[model samples]
Target: MTSTYDQLVEIVTKLHNPPADLIRPDVTFAQLDVDSLTLVEISLRIEGDLGIRIEDNELEEDLTLAATTQLIDAKLAQ
Candidate 1:
C-alpha cells in the first residue's frame, strides 16, 4: 500500500532544497530548515500529489515527519 510515510518521504525528497536520500519518519521539519512558507508549499504539494485537501490550521509547526505521515494516513483513511 502507498502508506502516508511513503508519500511524506516522496514529498520531502522532491521539495527539499538539498534533498535527503532517505527521510526518517521521526525527523523534524526544523531539522530540514523548513520554515512556515515551505510547510505551506508542502501542504499544497501534498494535496496535488495525493488528491486530498488539508486545512491550513491542521498542520502544526512542530509536526514531525512521522506525525505528519500519521495525519495524512488518517485523512486518507477517511
Candidate 2:
C-alpha cells in the first residue's frame, strides 16, 4: 500500500513540475496538468504496473490522488 502511494506520488510529481515539498494527497489532476490524454497514459501505465485494465468509464475526476490510490488498491485486491 505504501509502495503504491509512492508510485502515485512519483507519477504525479513527473506530470507536474511542482516543488518536491509541494506534493500531497489532496492534489487533483487539473492541478498537475493531467488532461485527458495524460490521464490515458497514466491509466495505461497503471495497468502495466498493476497488471489489470481499468475501464475508461472507471476513470473519473473524483479519482484524485487519495481517490486514485484507493481505486488502485481496490482493483489490485479484486
Candidate 3:
C-alpha cells in the first residue's frame, strides 16, 4: 500500500510536474513553484482524494512536504 507521505508526494508531482527529486520530504511549497490558486486546488484535491477536510488556516505558509504528510496522517488517524 502507498504510504500517505508517498501519496501526497504523488499528488504534488501531478499538480506541479516538478522534477522527481524536487518532490521529497524537505521540499516547501515555494520550491514547487505553485501559485496561491494552485495551493488551494491542491488542498482540495488532497481532501477529496484522501477523504479528509483541511481548513485553509491549517495550511500555513511555512508548511513543508513532510508536515503535509503528517497532517494527512493525523486526519486519517482521527
Candidate 4:
C-alpha cells in the first residue's frame, strides 16, 4: 500500500499539477498556491481516497504536507 504521504502527494498532484519539487514534505499548501476552495476539494479527496475524514478548519494553508500526513496517519490509527 502507498504511504499516507505518498497518497497525499498523488491527490494534490491530481488536483493542482504543481511542480514535483514543490510537493515536498516541508512545503505548505499555501506555497503551492492552494486557496480555500481548493483546500476543501483536497480535503474531500483525502477523505474519499484515504477513508479518513479531516475537517476543513484542520487543513489550513500553512499546514505542511508532512503535518497533513501526520494528521491523516493519526486519524487512521484511531
Candidate 5:
C-alpha cells in the first residue's frame, strides 16, 4: 500500500505538476509555488482520495510534505 506521504505527493503532483526532485519530504508547498487556490484543491483531493478531511485553514504553504503526512496520519488515528 502507498503511504500517506506518497499519496500526498501524488495529489500535489497531479494538481501542481511540480518537478519530481522538488517533491521531497522536506520541501514546503510554498517552495513549489503552490498558491491558495491550489492548496484548497489539494485539500479536496486529499479528502476524496484519502478519506481524510483536512480543513483549508489547516493547510499552510509553509508545511512540508512530511508535516502534512503526519497531520493526516494523526487525523486517521483519531
Candidate 6:
C-alpha cells in the first residue's frame, strides 16, 4: 500500500510539473523556481485533490516536498 506521504508526493509532483530528478523530498519550492502564483495554485490543487483545506498561512517560505507531504498527512489525520 502506498503511504500517505508517497501519495502526497505524487500529487505534488504532478502539480509541480518538474523533471523527474528535480522533484525530491528535500527540494524546496524555491529550488523548483516556481513563482508565487504557481505555489498558490499548487496549494489549491492539493486542497482539491486531498479534500483538505490548507490555510494560506500554513505555507512557509521554506516549503519543500517533504514538508508538504507532512502537512497533508497532518491535515488528513485531524
TM-score of candidate 5 to 2 decimals: 0.97
TM-score of each: 0.82, 0.78, 0.89, 0.96, 0.97, 0.79
Clashes of 1: 0
Candidate 1 residue 32 C-alpha distance from true site, Å: 1.4
lDDT per residue for candidate 1 within 5-78, as digits (tens), equals: 87777787778763564357777888777878778888999899987777888766678889998788788889
Q: Model 4 misses residue 23 by how many Å?
A: 1.4
- Candidate order by TM-score, highest to lowest? 5, 4, 3, 1, 6, 2
Model 3 residue runs over 4 Å out of place are none
**Which residues of candidate 2, in runs, are more than 4 Å off?**
14-21
**Local accuracy by lDDT, each model:** 0.78, 0.73, 0.83, 0.93, 0.94, 0.76
Residue-level lDDT tens digits of model 5 in 4-76 = 9989998999999998878799999999999999999999999999888999889999999999999999999
Task: Supply candidate 5's per-residue lDDT for 35.
Answer: 98
Candidate ordering by lDDT (highest first): 5, 4, 3, 1, 6, 2
lDDT of 6 by residue, 1-78 (tens): 787667766766776676778777888888877667777777788788778987877765478878878888888899
Which is the winner by lDDT between candidate 2 and candidate 5?
5
Candidate 2: the clashing residue pairs are none
Expressed as tens digits, the lDDT of each residue in 4-61 for candidate 4 is: 9999999999998998878799999999998898899999998898898999889999
Selected candidate, larger lDDT, 4 vs 6: 4
Model 6 misplaced regions, further than 4 Å: none
Mark the regions of model 5 whose C-alpha exceeds 4 Å error after superposition.
Answer: none
Sequence-dependent TM-score of model 3: 0.89
Residue 14, candidate 6: Cα error in Å is 3.2
